[model samples]
Every structure is written in C-alpha cells, then in structure tokens.
Target: MNNDIPKAVALRYDRELEDAPRVIAQGKGDIAKRIIELAIENGIPIHENPGLVDILMDLEYYSEIPEELYQIVAKVLILVYEIDKKYTSNFNNFLEQKGGANT
Candidate 1:
C-alpha cells in the first residue's frame, strides 16, 4: 500500500446567483497546511472528507464543481452555513452584552 500526505480542497459559493460552487483553492502537504491555517484564521468551516478531496483535487481552480459532486458539496455547504449562523449569533450576543450594537 502507498501512503500519501493529506490533501485539502476549498470551495466557494454565491447563493444569490450561482448555481454551483467553485473550487477556490486546493493543495497538498504544506500548501494544504497553509490553506487550513488561513481558513481557521478567517473563521471558515473546514470539513474533513478525504474522498471528496480526492475527487475535487482533480478540478481546476475556479472551476464549477461537477453535477456529480453536488450532493456531497451541498451537505458541506449546509454545515458551513450552520456554523456561520452560530458564529454570527454568538458574536452578536457578545456585542450586545458589551453594550455595542452589531454592525
């Protein structure tokens, strides 16, 4: 069996208009580390799905995800949305407690 370093793929979606998400960034090994780090720093949600990453890694950056991957990606997007909602709610609550209105 061959062992490979871990990989990561990042995606972007525009819910207002776009029909599909696009491959925003992807990398293996060190670059993968950086992508994950940046995501964490920016409060982006990260889903660990090596199988999905394997499939998405083949796509060119900025290319729309294929229809075959829509179901999987949809699940991930839902998770991200939920996380974002929770974070926003928490942040707003924090601001209110601090006597600062949410902007």
Candidate 2:
C-alpha cells in the first residue's frame, strides 16, 4: 500500500498538536471517556484495553493504518482543524466588533 498519505496525515496531526496543544487538549475533553460509554451503550467491543487516546495518538505517530481507516482519520483531523480555525476566527471577530479586547 502507498504510505505517503498516512505519513502526511500523521505529520499534520503532529504539527497541529505541537502548534496548539492546549486547544487540542481542551477539545478532547471527555472524548476518551465518552467513547467508552458509547461503545458500551451500543454493545461494541470493550476489551480491557489501554486508553484509547493513547492508542490513537500512537497510531497517528507510528502506525501504518489501512487506507480506509486512514481516510477516516484524515477527514476527522481536517474537520477538527477547520472547526478550530472557525471558532478562533469568530471569537476574534466578536472581540473586535465589541471592542472587548485587542490582538
């Protein structure tokens, strides 16, 4: 399988986390916890596994995920980045319009 896409996605994840770790961390609040709750609610596989966040991060950094899963991961990351940028931009616009703060 061609590995370039996965590598590029992983690199993007790494750069985003590095550039804005606090924002990323905040956005991930309860995500790991809720994933387990949802899995149990749906009767999905719930093995006695390690933290899903850690697993996913490791996969983002080191694993050669299949193309299908890679696409999902890439799309999710893009969505997250887009939402983050939108939120930040909107907040800045609000502040400017309201004269609440300066950049």
Which predicted model would earn the best lDDT? 1
Tens digits of per-residue lDDT for model 1, 1-103: 2247868899999978688999999998899999999999998888888888989999999999999999989998898889889989999888888885434
- Candidate 1 positional error at 25, Å: 0.7
TM-score to native of every candidate shown? 0.82, 0.38
- TM-score of candidate 2 to 2 decimals: 0.38
Candidate 2, clashing residue pairs? none
Candidate 2 overall Cα lDDT vs. reference?
0.43
Candidate 2 lDDT over residue span 19-66, tens digit each: 322112211335545655665585433333123233444443334444
**lDDT for position 24 in model 2:** 22
Question: With candidate 1 superimposed using the best TM-score fit, by how many Å does residue 23's alpha carbon deviate from the native?
Answer: 0.5
Q: Model 1, stretches more than 4 Å misplaced? A: 1-4, 100-103
